[model samples]
Target: MKYVVAWRERPTGSAAEYEAAQKRIREVLALWKMPASLTIHQFVARVGESGYAALETVEPADLQYLIAAFAPFSITVVPMMEVLDVAAGEPRGIEWRNGLPCTQP
Candidate 1:
């Protein structure tokens, strides 16, 4: 499954504190060797915002580990299933049902 993991660094008392937080984040990633199951599509900081957004294709079983890897940062994980393929002209008539994609007759 694919997941979007968005995170924002928690506010800190000083620049030193923020730098420490960054260091911890890097350490955690290195410690885990950056999970082999995850295929990162995009990982970038949000411009004009103090946060980051990452899109990755990951196995469901590895999801928890992915979340835990972020450690102390405020993070949100959204499970996503592609229901449309604009390039392929898929789901010509589909709709969102209760926040999920569904085909319409």
Candidate 2:
């Protein structure tokens, strides 16, 4: 499965605090190694102190380690599905929902 991992640094009061947070995050990235279950496709940092990555992994649980490693920053893990997959499944999904025995007026 593919995933989009995003992160934003938590609010800091002063410049020194921001620097400390950055240093810690960098240290973690520098020391911690990627696990075998994950494949990083792309990584980029935006103008703000936020960044996101496009990653592919077989086991969803592998991402827990990543979130833990970046505990200093607010992080999110979102599963990605191809546009074609959503389009193909739309009809079946609608059919299944319509077939439900109960409906709301």
Q: Which has the greatest TM-score?
A: 2
Name the best candidate (by lDDT): 2
TM-score of each predicted structure versus truth = 0.60, 0.86
> Residue 74, candidate 1: how far off, in angstroms?
0.8
Candidate 2: stretches off by over 4 Å:
100-105
Off by over 4 Å in 1: 47-58, 85-105
True lDDT of residue 20, candidate 2: 94
In candidate 2, position 45 carries an lDDT of 94
What value of lDDT does candidate 2 attain over all alpha carbons?
Answer: 0.91
* lDDT for each residue of candidate 2 in 1-105, tens digit (9 for 90 to 100): 999999988899999998998899888889998899999999999997789999999988789988988899899999999999989989998999899998667
Q: What TM-score number comes out for model 1?
A: 0.60
- TM-score, cand. 2: 0.86
Candidate 1 lDDT, 6-81, residue by residue in tens: 7777788998988898798778867675558778787787774445444565466566776676766777788765
